[model samples]
Target: MMATIVKGGSFVIDSSSWESIMTPEDLSEEQTLIAEAAEHFIENEVLPHDGELEKLDYKLTVQLIRKAGELGLLGVDVPEKYGGLGLDKVSSTLISEKLAKGSSFALSVGAHVGIGTLPIVFFGTPEQKRKYLPDLADGSKIAAYCLTEPSSGSDALGARATAKLSDDRTHYVLNGAKQFITNAGFADVFIVYAKIDGKHFSAFIVERTMEGVSIGPEEKKMGIKGSSTCPLILDQVKVPVDNLLGEPGKGHVIAFNILNIGRFKLGAGCVGAAKDAISLSAAYANERTQFGKPISSFPLIGEKLADMNIATFVLESMVYRTAGLIDAVLQNIDHGSDAAGVQSAKGIAEYALECSINKVFGTEALDFVADEGVQIHGGYGFIQEYKIERIYRDSRINRIFEGTNEINRLLITGTLLKKAMKGELPLMEHAQSVQESMLEPTEQSDTDERFAQEKRLLATAKQIFLLVGGQAVQTYGLELEEQQEVLARLSDMMIAIYAMESALLRAEKITAKSGEKRGELASIMTSVYVHDTFASIERAAKQSVAAMASGDLLSLQLSVLRKWTRHTPPDTIRLKRQVAEKVKAAERYVVV
Candidate 1:
């Protein structure tokens, strides 16, 4: 395992090497094979039954989940002693990504393998693991994540669900409702969160057969319709004392840390779904003719495909790179030890900012691609007869899933500021450095380098973030948390910086490994994304600065922003056209 060279939330101020980060291009043969197997399974088994699953066939969903377990797909993250393969984060991530090609079936498996089963794998005790992990691993028992309640979607701590110790002291009676529970229809096991005695937030392993446990009717949803989503009604459900996950009052720790991990997998799944949309649209573009030529041949259609391709390419890079960060920390831990749960949760929590960033960016990017896919398919895209229609519908829930994009956005900046305050990341110091550097003479960058233009632009974007962020700090001080607008805009800038750097570093790595000629596509995609992203960051920074201050104060900030945003963007039209040619030729996301 590579030692963690960049601390969590430190990428904003840290300089990283192209070779230090991992990319899809760096996947080992074993990891690649596992991903391929998952892809094969999705194509052969799940997609073939799309119609049945779409009809909300609960039995088929159960059977398919077991089939996934039979392949050891469900156990990739589980420890070996407990009947799991205990693979690294990369393999599990790839499996998550690949399963997404099967549409909403991916949601069922994702809910099962990720939020459903992982809490036990990571936090359950020896007896808990011995009893539950094997059944979960073998698919004999299905799992569901029950966190969101009707009243408290984003504010998890605001949960009204209550748990009280039974008079016999042998069990706890759980009484509450968990809403939008994925796999609730058929899950044998549920990881439920409720307030202990209506006060302390806690997690519990609730069995399906527990007395007074019942599932509400499946929701009539906008997307991911195949995935069973129902309300879990806990009416005096008696859960054994041993089933309390982690600790009595430390459930928030378990819940938030598990959410970070869920965000990671959610990001990967979005990437896979986006790829499927791209391929489907590309194929349709070639087959559908308009005025004596294929729509794929039209520049307008090509442009949409190119933009979609670049966004997904960068999102893919961000996901795998973040996975590498998680794996590096997870590598040395002894999974069998009692402290493994705490240790693993800490490891996963380290990258909470990136996880949220991925969740927001990946989902939004997939939504854009799915929308374009339908557009490219023309009228057919809207009809149920076309797969893109379902893809479009499924894409909407992602923004709201894991956490709403709005919540994740707030968390992204909220976590960053909290890190700054705690001295975990040198964000304030970094911002100060940027402030001081503005007075110094700017150094001219070498324009002859492999990606001189893009490197300069990315650097400027970071500086812009630092400058604006520093000003916000100087103005707001401790009260900045209430400035949601400013903080959210800061998050936008941070997201831009992260995505641009991820793509740029990945392109650089590819160039170094495969020669400049062979790495042109990667480089081109990086350049295009960085150009567009930098423009977006410029606006976000200015908007943030304006919102924080007005009149002369805003002018001073705007001047600094103008200085940083002065770099000319690459010719995106030509670059994107070249990108379109490659994607149109391949009819898929070939950058992988």
Candidate 2:
């Protein structure tokens, strides 16, 4: 099958070679060793202190972060010149995934490595990097990102913070309150975004010792309480001119580009957290007996476990595939070049759609895994003593973090449309082809019988998406921005499409490597995911078409959608049982 992808504002998808993408199964020996080290750190340091960390022990949290830095876990993406390991995106993703098992401690490290430090790594000046990167890399200085204000959450540009130039042009006086600042209570550095003279939006590096900089009392939260979340009060804090990050009035560039990286990393973290939840839930089921057998022996409980494993598999596949794609693009750029920062940011931004898709899909998948885990634990799941309970709470914030799932959904379609408008992606042309296909009888394409049905369903899902999405775009034009519900539905279809494709490709790769017999489990899981998600794709497409069209037009579109979506539903019960047997035997997620 052919596909188009936008990278660095250009189309880079080669139809004939489109199937080549990385998967978790491709991890190298060295990468595996790095992941093992992170796992060891989590087991030795983070997990043992879970209780103390939960009690908001800021000192222990800082100590843990420093320990991670000492172990080189905090500098996976930073350049070696900056006292970092300067690893690839995949390695960084692996670290994020492993750290996620640490629970709230993972959030502390994630914010530090992602939003907190990337601005300097990606956009800071030579002096800025020289002064801060070493300390950040070595964990001597902890960092926090101050973006959301009480008045601004998703509307980040609406921040009330103001920075004014001093009379001598030596410093900018910053005044504002940033709410829910992660790592606020203990972070030594903060990436603050404030409007200059209440006009030009910008970002600044503010030190904890700066005059008039103070953190409010930590907010008692629902989840991840081990990580500090507080309001930062900048009461006429004077930040030196040298601390300005990026260019004046161009803070959004940093804010957004860094967020793209954060979104994918957040997805990777979710994958790790989901795996942890699956392991705990499966172990609990194996131990807890009801009637004559363990709860895991029950089909209903087994089904839940199977579903969790399946979702985690798909999420892991997508996360690594994206990381590999980003890494491949970034590897070609010289990190020391003057324009490297811009090039790097563009490289990451190239897959903004995929990043947002991963964020929305991975977080929701983790939430599902966590919820089912709690369900499998029954009453024990609700008790704080149970790890599942804390996991349930911790998973809640992911949807709202990076960007709200809603915002990310909008971004998914919005970015695709922008790329289409810029001629960077041929989405419109593909949509036009789908529209044309609807006018004629369906034409069959040859494929290996092993995945023929899935391949066909995937193609149809894309058609449904293009049909509805194209109609919406044409009907509303620029006003399509207001059709958020329709746009969200379209985003759902795209998310499902991407998820299914990732799983299918991974399964195909494994099957090719190990043959059909050895790859049976992957084939089963992929089939289950693709078949089930195709139904969801059809539903979302139909809903979008219904909302955008009416009467005869809506009816006609629905008919065409049905034609494309037609497929025999697989025996998912049998598939789930097969998946469950593997998961049960392994005592955890075993797709890898």
Tens digit of lDDT per residue, candidate 2, span 1-592? 3223336322212121225778888899989999999999999998899899989898999998998999999988888877888888999999999999899999999999999999999999988998999889979999999999998999999999999999999999999999999999999999999999999999999999999999999999989988999999999999999999989999999999999999999999999999999999999999999998999999999999999999999999889888878987788788866567678888899898889999999999999999999999999999999999999999999999988999999998889889889887788888787788796887655465888898888777777777887899889998999999998998888888788888888898888887888778888999999998988887787777777789998888888877777667779999999999888888888974
Output the number of the lDDT-best candidate. 1
Over 4 Å off, model 1: 443-445
Q: Find the candidate with the highest TM-score and give its number.
A: 1
Report the C-alpha lDDT of model 1 over 132-206, residue by residue, as the tens digit. Answer: 999999899999999889999899889988999988999989999999999999999999998888888889999
TM-score of 2: 0.97
Candidate 1 residue 250 Cα shift, in angstroms, is: 1.4
Cα shift from native, residue 253, model 1 (Å): 0.7
Angstrom error at residue 491, model 1 = 0.4
